[model samples]
Target: MKATNEIKPRLDVVSRAITSIVEGVCKENDFDIQYSGIESTDGLPVRQLPAIWDALKTAKARMNHQMNQLISRITHRWNLASSIHRLPAEVLAIIFQEFEPIPGHPDGDSSLLNLLLVLRAWYDAITGSPQLWRSFGAHTPYNIARLVVDHSKALPISVDWRPPREPPKRDLGKVLDLAIENSARVKSLTASVPHEGDPHL
Candidate 1:
């Protein structure tokens, strides 16, 4: 038998074959199939119903899997032929840097974090670029700050620390201390200390 991949049927032929199969099944069972439901209220054999249901479920799963595979292959091929992928690592890194969130912007880390999830190539390009990780926001956690510092590769980093309205569980002093330890590398700093009336200052 020929492999399934080797068989290429025309779209019309495939459609007709499917239609014929449905028509034949309906004709043999003395059933009239409709879009919503069967026309006749006649019931199928109880024993055969389970088998048919299971077969339909299995076929549906198989079709879904095959469709997913086809889509993935097409996406992979499209990416391969894309000009973005052809860019040099330096150029790609610059592009990724452009996606970095602006200082003091809410949800600062989200954009870069999402970029990391796009593709392996994009992840590699962003991760391998140290300059892109130089900016740190006030809400940035210790671990994330550490990661950015480590990746900054001795380059100067920008720090933005805005006092929150509510006091945080973690010691803000310690967080500042961590950033202070790397203060020599600090290029741009923006910090707001809470005041007596304004906790959000």
Candidate 2:
């Protein structure tokens, strides 16, 4: 019927528009099409897509065996390209860097380190990146101390002691000692004493 023909094309357009909007939302949310196996980027259960299933049903009814074969080939290619290991080291590192560790995101440092354990390639690239190491201050008795030791000779040193809810765990005297220790080499020195009641130090 002519009426059915016009409605079918309009329905197809609506389905495609919905698909495009869902894809955009996923990308903005930092999720990929391959994030979960069955679902598409829009969180749609692939099985429930009436348009896609209808097309397959139509092909089957028409005895279009080649359509199934084509679908299999496309699925294979998609799986290979979407593998996390297929990503370049530089690209992965950049993605990891997006979750920067700061007061706002205290657990970011540990999370990035955990991500490094996923595979040898991620571990090597993350550990080897200097930009990743720069955020962890040398004052913290962590491995970043080496970077501070090496760069302290020329770089300006700024230390901010932000204690948790309790009183200052690190003594003010110790911070003053560090300032004096690098007084000759540091171009600028900044030290923050957390007020007894202030949340923003």
Candidate 3:
């Protein structure tokens, strides 16, 4: 949660602190804050005392927290340095609109949506671009269909009701309702009977 300005310096400090302590720690398991530091658990002079144990526990907790912070700092740096991060959100939105679904990808837009969320930038681009949500089909998953409808906002949308399967789709009714609810913005519609006994049907 630290700002970039704060994170860079703090990360350097954490890295230095970790490097310093790692030089002193005798082993990975032994965590002690004694002046001379703890080399090992076997026959450690302070191991028998409660205060020493408390100090070690605190040290362990501190190390764990620091490790977590280190990971966060690294991730923050990675995101900032990533090539995708260099692309503007508007450009990402345009890219999303131009992208086509993979051939025979069973999950359709669902997989694309899930994949786009890996980066904060891509997620924002997809969710914030109403034009990207302006074209979808009745067979889309209910939740995804809703997202498309809601995110499309006042933009005109094109609906495809051509079924992908024999039974059509279970969510067809819900998708129809969504289209009708936003009928004022429905600029284009495509639907037809399955054509009984048709080979593609």
Candidate 4:
């Protein structure tokens, strides 16, 4: 993802520059053909036709950038046709839940999320699985957190905000809102309060 984020903009810049040059060359070629009044290459000055042909060939080669796109499309199709897609949706959902750690656990395996990302074809199965969305963490934004809670299908959930930096100096009001709102369904709760300077415990 880091490489992708960096390389994509550079590729876009190069593609745009090449497209501009190609358009300019095309305009020049069209006007020259009209101005020459030659019905065919046979009537053109000696050697000029060969030079034009060479330039056209060079332009075509410069446009070989499309070859990368062709390869990408081929790989994309290959991934889409992978045998893993043949698994039933229920099986996929179960497998994802097996690999995914309890939501909002202190030592959850973050890398498992990366594994799920690689299996792009199984997005529906993963998101549709209620077991995978049963955790709430302070790091999740409010909007997405709401959706995650909603996706849990009213199952009792663990609420965790135990990271030291959470709640920004451990403001209890800010950190406990969601847990309070969903108190009925919150089965386990953990939080951290920075008590370094507080006179009151």
Query: lDDT per residue, candidate 3, 1-201, as tens digits?
Result: 977676455666765665456434423445543332234344555544554456556777998998899999989889989988889988877777655332222345445576475887777778888877776675676777788778878888887776566455677688778878888887888777768886656
**Residue-wise C-alpha lDDT for candidate 2, range 111-137, written one tens digit per residue:** 665776666667766766655543333
Q: What lDDT score is found at residue 134 in candidate 4?
A: 72
lDDT of 1 by residue, 1-201 (tens): 889579777887866655554444545555544322343323555555555455556666776898899989988888877888888879998888877755563556458878887777888888888978887666766676777888889888898887654554274566678788999999998876677877443
| Model 3 worst lDDT run, 10 consecutive residues | 100-109
Q: Per-residue lDDT for 67-99 in model 4, tens only? A: 778878888888878888878778987777766
- What's the distance in Å from true for residue 76, model 3? 1.5
Higher-ranked by lDDT: 2 or 4: 4
Kindly report which residue stretches of model 3 are placed more than 4 angstroms away from their true locations once superposed: 1-39, 44-62, 100-111, 166-171, 195-201
Per-prediction TM-score: 0.68, 0.37, 0.61, 0.55
In model 1, which residue pairs have backbone atoms overlapping below 3 Å?
Answer: none
Arrange candidates by lDDT, highest first: which order? Answer: 1, 3, 4, 2
Candidate 4 lDDT: 0.63
What's the true lDDT of residue 43 in model 1? 56
| Candidate 3 displacement at residue 86 in angstroms | 2.7
Error of 4 at 119 (Å): 4.0
Candidate 4 wrongly placed segments (more than 4 Å): 1-69, 101-106, 139-144, 163-175, 191-201
